[model samples]
Target: MPKVIDHDQRRKEVVDVTWQLIVEGGIEAATMREIASRAGFANGALKHYFSGKDQIIKGAYERSLNNLGDRLAAHTAGKRGIEALEMFMRFTLPIDQEDATAARVLLSFWERCAFSPEIHGGYDEHLDSWKAGYLQYLAEGRADGDVLTPTPDEQLVDEIIMLNIGATVVRVVSPDHLNAHVLEAQVTDFIARLRRAE
Candidate 1:
């Protein structure tokens, strides 16, 4: 019998390798040849899994978003109110290697979005999903009387999103100015300000 291949697994392996390359050296580093070589596949073999570099990058981008979703779920599970909001905010900070990698990779994709329509569309959707998730958590806090932000829901959500993005950029580009503790404290302080007096 001829050897059987797991196509989905191979594709995931390729995406993983590509993501690592992006994390280490930005999106430009994730070329088809490099991905195939690093993924232990022949150059032509990668074409079987992905039509080209664009497809591979898209796959890797979605994988990173999915990862963010999973981490948020894990952190926010069995929690609500300010606790859940804080947990979700932690996902935006460079609290560890995983969060740092995701933020860096996302930054790279955002740059690419200016040039690639495919990346632009996918990134917009991914961003919408994140915004929706944050809104849900914030709404929960408000319903529980913990989030006392007087701003409209949409504006409050936008401010939170901007804060997280700003924090990620500062930490990723100028590490000396921000550390995990500082990031966590910033989030905690923000949530504290949102609390309503009993």
Candidate 2:
């Protein structure tokens, strides 16, 4: 019998290799030839799994988003109101090496998004999911009397999202300036300010 191949597994392996390349050297480093070689596949083998480099990059980007989502779920499980929101925000930050690696890969995709409609669409989808989650948590906090901010939930979501993105960039680009401890303190203060005053 001819050798059997696990297409999905091969595709995932290709994406993983590509992700590492991008993380180490930005998106430019994830060339098709390099990915295939790194993945132990013959030249042009990637075409079987992805249309081209763009799709592979998209796969890596989606994987990063999925990883973060899983982390968020685990961190926020059984939590509610301010607690859930804090966990959500904290996990979103690049406070640890793993989170920072994901952030760096995401930043690479952000640059591609300006030129790739598919990547831009994926980015928008991820942002929408995050916004929905933020609104849900904010509503829950309001119901539980944990949040007393007069600001509209939408506005607060925007601020929180901006802060997360900005902080991720700063953390990745200037770790010494915004180290993990500083990030944790900043998030704590931000969340505390959202709660009702005693």
Candidate 3:
């Protein structure tokens, strides 16, 4: 019998290789052939799991988002409101490697969207999903009195989401060049503004 490798594991392995390539040599290094070579798989192996560059791009986007989502879900378990809010914020930090990798790859994919409308839509959906996580934290805070802001105007939430993502790009690619702590504090300040009055 041929090797019975678990498809999911191989997919994760390829993605993990692609993630490293992106961080080390930019997204261009993640070209199918390069990624396949780095992963020790045939040039076409990626196709078995993805349709083409666009699909891999979308899969990378999904993979990166899931990395954060899975962590946020774990952090929020059995927690509520600000507690969950704090945990969610921590996952966005660049202090951790997987989080950093996810952030870097995500921004790379965002840039890729400029060339492909399909990836553009996928990127938007991925972003919206993240915003939903933040919204969940904000809504939970609102219900628990931790969010004192007046229903958090849509623009503000959008700004927060954009700002965090922007900062993530900076922190991921150039840690020595940017301070993750400053961005974290910026987010914390916003969250604090949402807390109930004394």
C-alpha TM-scores of all predictions: 0.89, 0.95, 0.82
Mark the 10 consecutive residues where model 1 has the least summed lDDT: 189-198
C-alpha RMSD values across all candidates: 2.1, 1.5, 2.8
User: Candidate 3 — which residues are off by over 4 angstroms?
Assistant: 1-9, 196-198
In terms of TM-score, which candidate is stronger, 1 or 2?
2
- Better candidate by lDDT, 2 or 3: 2
lDDT of 3 by residue, 1-198 (tens): 888888888887777777778777768888888888987888677788766777666666777777777777887899887787677666766646666767778778878889998789876776687678677777777787667776554655687677777677777667776665676677677677677453
Tens-digit per-residue lDDT, 1-198, candidate 2: 999999999999998999999889988898888999999999987888899778999999989988988988899999988889999998998989999899888888888899999679978988998899999999999999989878888998998889888887786677788888988998888787788454
Number of backbone-clashing residue pairs for each candidate, in the order shown: 0, 0, 1
* Model 1 / residue 28 / CA error / Å: 2.1
Compared with the true structure, all predictions reach lDDT values of 0.80, 0.88, 0.73
Ranking by TM-score: 2, 1, 3
Positional deviation of residue 168's Cα in model 1 after best superposition, in angstroms:
2.5
lDDT of 3 at 160: 68
Residue 119, candidate 1: Cα error in Å is: 2.2
TM-score for candidate 2, please give it: 0.95
Clashes of 1: 0
Worst 10 residues of 3 by lDDT: 148-157
